[model samples]
Target: MSTTAPIRLGTRRSALAQAQSGHVAEALSAIAGRPVELVPIVSEGDTNRASLSEIGGTGIFANLLREALVAGKCDILVHSLKDLPTAMPPELVIAATPARVDARDVVITRDGTPLHELRTGSAIGTGAPRRIAQVRRRAPHAKVVDIRGNVDSRLARVESGDLDAVILAAAGLSRLGSESTLHREELGLAEWPTAPGQGALAVETTVDAPAELLAALAELEDEDTRLAITVERAILAGLDVGCQAPMAAHAVVSGDSVRVRAVVYEPNGEGRIGLDVTESLNRGYIRRNGSGNEANAADGADPMRTARDIGDSAAHRLLEQGAADFLPRE
Candidate 1:
């Protein structure tokens, strides 16, 4: 038997998952000074793509990997932060959140066509309820179809002449070096606020893991990203919503501050709520102490509690502003 021990890194079988896991594994290898082998785990999300709503939520993607970690099948699990549920199982913990990539949404079209230039009646494909609601609000004429699959499959649908365009996360395309497929004009944050934690990679481990491992993994934590996502996830949890709702939020770290924006939509383009909230970290309670939890008398007890407070506050304002009852009966 060989003397060296390999750390097993569990991930889904999709190209995006493999690419993401490979990147994380490389970092872990360099940090640990040892070999880390990626073990592809075919998840329920991969096998059951009939409908996300019909199954569970996007949490399906993280479930199996978390299971693998708990079962001693793997030492670590890497996930797209957006796909992970706000509340983790008691036994698992999000050990680290590395530096984030592009966190905006991008539109991909055939022949590199722009959204406005597409045929008036052309069909646009997307799987996200948030994207559909936002796209419909912007382009009321286009026929929106629900297209689900891995990134490659979704992009392939456009190339197969079945879709005029599709919306995807800019981070994924950047990671895969597939920017050639994007339409430059629609890549702005004003046009599309990304899903919470869209471009971030999260590392998860069993709660009972050795402190040495946790501490080692925690070295990769990006405080700016953790704070940004904390606010984003807070917005989501505040809304009492999951991936099923038409919700989008994004935050940017600007010199000891974070500017967060959130939006909610009705499916038929009737009602919407949006806000640009800024917190100056250097001037706030977080400046003295690293946690924003200190600034939450108005928001609630915790950071997420405050986020929920802000989300509800925004939702109520939107409702008052005549946000229509376009929420679908799913």
Candidate 2:
């Protein structure tokens, strides 16, 4: 706690990465009463403009930063939770994820048009397999094209007539301050559930991090956000799927129950295995504190176990209903 050196937070040099890390730095600084400097690290993913599937690596945005962390080049690493692989290395962990923003995807189109109003056969650009499947399912006539770039660059395609529309994370656009100025439509979550942890940030550190730093970071953890994403990712892990595959999972916490919905799509986007399941967190969380209430709520439950159960059960339900048939082959 007495270290005079500011904590170096490693991040990709992209504008979005800088912005997200900058936000985390401010929060951590306040919590630790110490300075947090954002250290820009160029990730291989940032360097490669090819499609993610073409690149063929997991945690494209995060692995490079992780290398830096392990090498003592940075004290902290921030990642888009969705870009993080479902499995964490034994030496590493996500220490915190601030409260989540909108977890839904949005479409930005030329002429300020929404998805339903777009013309037939229009080229809609997106690099994500999950988005491609949903787009094809909801708008059968539109064409899905692979695209690679930052938020602004992708948005520019629509302006320059290279594409009639583009799909992006509403959370990213909002963080970059471009959500309101552009014409966009937020997709319905029921039909277009997003990636496991889309819209959430992952704050990673080594398992043996300084106790002071770990405690400070924990102050920023949002239990609700963590549990929701954990459930989504657990379902993914239970199904043994990769990010490049066509899959989407969404979780919502309502009262005492957590409702989780997941879908695994055929590569062609012509079919899918969709299922929804709910799990009660009451037993796992409430009994920990003798006089449990809102102030004591966060630590009151073992949400991680509950989330795993929900995810595993949901994936099992889908498998029972033939989810495996639609999954992409290894």
lDDT of 2 by residue, 1-330 (tens): 356679889999999989888999999998888999988999888888888767754677778889999888988898989888888989898999899999899888766777866789999998888888778887788888999998988888888889998999988987887643457888888878999988999899999999988998899898888888988888888887776668889998776688888998876678988987777866334333555553354554666787888888888888898878876654
C-alpha local distance difference test of each model:
0.75, 0.84
Query: Once superposed on the true structure, which residue ranges of model 2 sit more than 4 Å away at CA?
Result: 179-181, 283-301
Pairs that collide, model 1: 238-308, 271-323, 271-324
- Give the least accurate 10-residue stretch of model 2, judged by summed lDDT: 283-292
Give lDDT: candidate 1, residue 147: 73
- Residue 85 in candidate 2 has what lDDT? 81
Number of clashes recorded per candidate = 3, 1
TM-scores vs. true structure, each candidate: 0.85, 0.92
Best prediction by TM-score: 2
Error of 2 at 46 (Å): 1.0
- Mark the regions of model 1 whose C-alpha exceeds 4 Å error after superposition: 1-4, 53-56, 179-185, 282-330
- What does the lDDT read for residue 257 in candidate 1? 64
